[model samples]
Target chain A: MPPLVLHHLSVNYQDLRALRNINLTIHPGQLVGIFGPNGAGKSTLIKAMLGLIPRVTGRVTWGEADLSAHLERIAYLPQRSQIDWHFPATAWDVVMMGRVKPTGWLRPFAASSRRLAQAALERVGMAELAHRPIGALSGGQQQRVFLARALAQEAEIFCFDEPLVGVDQATTGIIFKVFRDLAAAGKMVLVINHDLGESITNFDQLILLNQELIAAGPRQWVLSPEHMRRAYGGEVGFWGHVA
Target chain B: MLPEMGPIHWLLDPLQYDFMLRSLAVAVMVGIICAVVGSYLMVQRLALLGDAISHSVLPGLALAFWLGGNIFLGAFIAGVLSTVLIAWIHRQSSIKEDAAMGIVFSAFFALGITLITVIQKENKIDLNHFLFGNILGVTVADVRDTAIIAALVLGVVVLIYKELLFYSFDPMGARASGLPVGLLNSGLMVLIALTVVASMKVVGVILVLSLLITPGATAYLLVPRLHQVMILGCGIGVFASLSGLYLSYYFNLPSGAAIVLVVSALFSLAFLFSPSQGVISRYRRRP
Candidate 1:
């Protein structure tokens, strides 16, 4: 697969510059993490790249085409908080949503789609609770269900925003294992992560940001004290001790 | 006279009148379509948008009558325009959506009331009929128009069920996964406009929000899935319409008010007694 590339991406919220002049190249078979202090445009970067939100200036290309033109190749898991847990859908119902674009318009889900959704639920250990309402699931279980949805999309690129927040260790393990499996299969996996704990070790590369690209390289290089201090300001001391 | 009639005759007596038959047919169709479309409004927490659109359609109705055009078409255009205006105001300015809706809908409503009041001085129209609905005055053409709108709304909804489900549940995920979020949103607005316009004669603009929200909310309390909510809501809406018409016939109550009252009662029952989410059930489950 051709690398996913961003050229001078920037985003503004009215007068406030949320992200500025971000450039990165993400290769296939890499599990990448984006780290930043709160309000550092971590989520904004992912959203801008995917064209979910407007970008002030940038070009995002996957292979030879604009990324916006080939969005079907992407599987995106938004922050869990962004979803309405009270929506009246079962775990199985949400997983089947992944097949909607692939199934094309005006056609019901075929038997093959149903099998894929079922397999995805089973992969997340949620098959037994397939019929349960999503609102009734625990936080970790809800996150797992969304993960199952992304897996069912069968896309070449995966983007997850804060999938680890408010989730259990078991859920975290399952998530990392799935991310690794996707990477091993030669798919690009990018995750926006809040924690810099031991979980940070799971990423093959890190992109640290504070309204701009502070550093982007292998995990250890991007986590260096100087780069951490630059991106996080005075909070670096807390992160340094943790690191 | 009451002692001589059987239960079946009492039920069948209303069917003898052609006007009653037309009203019943239109009411049933309105019930089904409103519940289906209203499920989306309730789930997305855009119940106020429904109220906004319904109220805003009045100006179109007045203008269409003044121009001798089809009032349903006019109302649909006005409803859609109000939503677009609300979105535009919200996006172009820092005004939040709820405030924008409030401003635009009330402005349009005021314009409608003004136009109707001025037009009624010369014409034989009654503003109260439009406000409260005159379902008994529905003509054959009105029934036919409502049927077509109902079919179109239900057909599009059925075809795009999964896409709508995904979009409504997680808009960012759906948009990122290649769905045309804007087109889907516009299509929903159009469907809602059609549903509101089709329902106007049965419930009036003032009370159509009740038909659009109450039945679906009642079913939402009882069911755990969107399709289930819609299906059950349809049943609830139709039952309320049928029973309310009967009560209106027997007690000489206004048809629209009677239907709204019945649907509200059903929602109250669900609120108090639904098995999973009801007040009583949750209270009973407590230790």
Candidate 2:
């Protein structure tokens, strides 16, 4: 439950400036949403924080400690398209991957780890399809399986990149329910979402970006019409979650 | 001749010859190592890297021959070097990895071919043995070397199975979880190189690509886990090796080509009849 701080972060992909001069402090118990149009560097920011990508400048610290030093307590769910659905792994196998770090090398998964994985599957409503190969599952089912993987990790800080895209309504509901529960339990939950529909209301805080920080704060203060125009270019509608 | 011989005699008669016995032991060991290392290559979608590394080992083999050093060690060094060059080229330039692999491997392969030709004029070694393999020419030392490599490869795989599994399945996730992906990747490259060097006598450089990729791919159709794929692929590889050896003995065929054909035939069977992912069943599904 430590606060995370980002100081003057920037990323360069060759000549392109993906993220520029970003700074923020994220506290626990917040369900944070990173919203922007395509190419806004939403996914890159998260990757950079976790050191999945090397940042050109700046630093990220989790409660006065380097984020890399505390990676075991973090769980990341990559976007769906980034994964090969045709990979020859069952849903149970994917969830068990969450237990991999804790289970470590030269050893097998403990009984407790297996029980945790089973519980995660049940929590995500995918227990019945646990034995099914990942390729056989629909888009929504795949996302749910990944969510279950994150839950099985028992991580303190959970980050998801586009978890709701192309999923069914049932899946959306279940995911939001779980995110809320995770936040309520004093865990820091960060999500990268491109959707601005009804689901945007679930966030406790919002960080809008379009290659640079637009505005970041409580949802109400961050989603003003002015900020919306700067991030999405012109009016992009605000029917579902805008108050 | 084999038709008249009982299956027991067909199997037992080979044991009388010391050279055949050495070939048999080396063939089995190569089968296991190739399948084990090849499983990782298949799952990572780096099958071409297998081709790249196999071809890249040539320059090393040539250089070792020139320097009066162990060709096997040279091949391993060149194999690892090619991967590093490929990675460096990919990162430093805008070129895609596949393109980088294509450029590096062909250049190294060409260098190897030229060097071998130059050396062959002065030496008595047949270039065919390096290109297509001569399993019948294996010695007791070859058997011992293959055994050691097999043990090392299987031991590392056992020790790091979980990390490799996690890394191959989701590299981004593995990196985020603090696993040293660069080291793991290099370790895998080293293993793949060792497998290629160990397999040179059983199936030469040009054909080792098939041994490295085909068995795992065949098993992938039938199994649903990485380890299962490796275990079943090893079985398929060993079966192909033994059957090919037997076929060569009875029919006066080239052992390497015969083994490759047996493996290809087995791959066709799995492609058409595997329970979960067979073409026959999958094609039968309708909207």
Candidate 3:
């Protein structure tokens, strides 16, 4: 588990600058949260690190290796809206997609891959619905299915974008528990969160950004009054205290 | 003084005519490839892209005809060009993809129709033959061409099935998993163009979208997986093509039009009665 490092990262969506030169290092065994207000580059920060979008500047590396070259060792969950739920695949089929790269091309999935996929579904409490159409599932169930898919990848780095959006309480609890378990097992877990809600307490570390990094460290260290004001104005400190 | 044959004889009698054999060969090949490739389009919500490429191929056909070159190659190039142009326009501007497709395809289609109409006035070639198709008049050369394209399309689909399935279901995830998304996307565009070009001789550009989309959609209503949708769609496409070909033979109707009609009729049946997702099934489950 190499430390994920981003040095001088910047992103531009056409003429609008979405993120400025941002530097950070995420060590193994840490569950980190990227927090920001709307249009504050929280999502852009993750996408830039993963090289998903066109970068205006900088590179990302995992220890000595380039991140792009090591993408297969990472598991990523995009925002829910990025998926087409109406596609004809079932939960079992989708979880099996995680094994595609590992199984390689021009060959069928191994029996072990099937066992892993089924175990992933069982973990997410979606085992019974493995054969149901994805479109028929509730929003929370859909999110759980995707999480199971990422888990089945068995990667050292787990990246999620807005995983908690529109999900029920049970799914959120299960997701956080799994994230903690992965972190305890020495995996690099990075999450993009949109709110200063009750769930903020679950993150072990925090990277506060508003177009740039205002502060990043342990949760208590990054949530100071001064840092909060710099990132999201003074009013946010009140919301933070409430949470 | 009438001649009569058994039902089996009537069905088998068509195989005795060389022209009928050629038409049936083209129909089956077109059906197989269309259903297979069209399943991708249906899942990606790009069914209209099939229509767009089909229409855009007309100019290529007219130009190739004028140049006394291969119409299939010309139409294929034109179809791919249309998709590229659509992607370029959509990416480089504020225009959405749907609007971009509409703008580019209509322009190419108009150019093609104008060129073909003008060429028709001077040559013995009939414009209606290209617009409505002359499946019964397909040469052995056309059958061979269709077979080659069908084999190529089905081969590529089989070779890249799992990767394509992952990409189609969640492209961002596939890319994040280190798949060559750009290459897969380009290959899909090429496959789509080939399917459209091969189909033009059987259903014509104006009606080819139905063959490319209807059967897949019909199967989608009854299935729970992408590959199943494609296989079932192929089966439905073959059945409809056979029945429609026979109906046309008995009633003196246009073979291509009759085939499309049969395909749509099957789709309507699936829409109404598929057990898992159909309107009738849902209504019954509600009570």
Q: Every prediction's TM-score for the first chain?
A: 0.97, 0.97, 0.97
Off by over 4 Å in 3: A240-243, B1-6
Weakest lDDT window of 10 consecutive positions for candidate 2 chain A: A234-243
Off by over 4 Å in 2: A237-241, B1-3, B283-287
> Sort by DockQ, best first: what order?
1, 3, 2
In candidate 2, position B183 carries an lDDT of: 93
Best by lDDT: 1
lDDT, residue A177, candidate 2: 95
**Per-residue lDDT of A166 in model 3:** 93
Judge the docking of candidate 2 as incorrect, acceptable, medium or high. medium
Give the clashing residue pairs of candidate 2, or none: none
User: TM-scores of all models?
Assistant: 0.98, 0.96, 0.95
Tens digit of per-residue lDDT, candidate 2, span A131-235:
998989989999999999899999999999999998999999999999999999999999999888778889999999998999999998888888888898866
Rank by lDDT (best first): 1, 2, 3
lDDT of 3 by residue, A1-243 (tens): 678888899899779888999998888898899898889998788777877898988989987878999888888899989998999999898999999998898898899999999999999999999999899999999999999999999988999999999999999999999999999999999999976878999998999999988988999898887888888775664765633
Report clashes for each candidate as comma-separated counts.
Answer: 0, 0, 0
- Per-residue lDDT value at B63 in model 1: 96
- Residue B87's lDDT in candidate 3: 96
Ranking by TM-score: 1, 2, 3
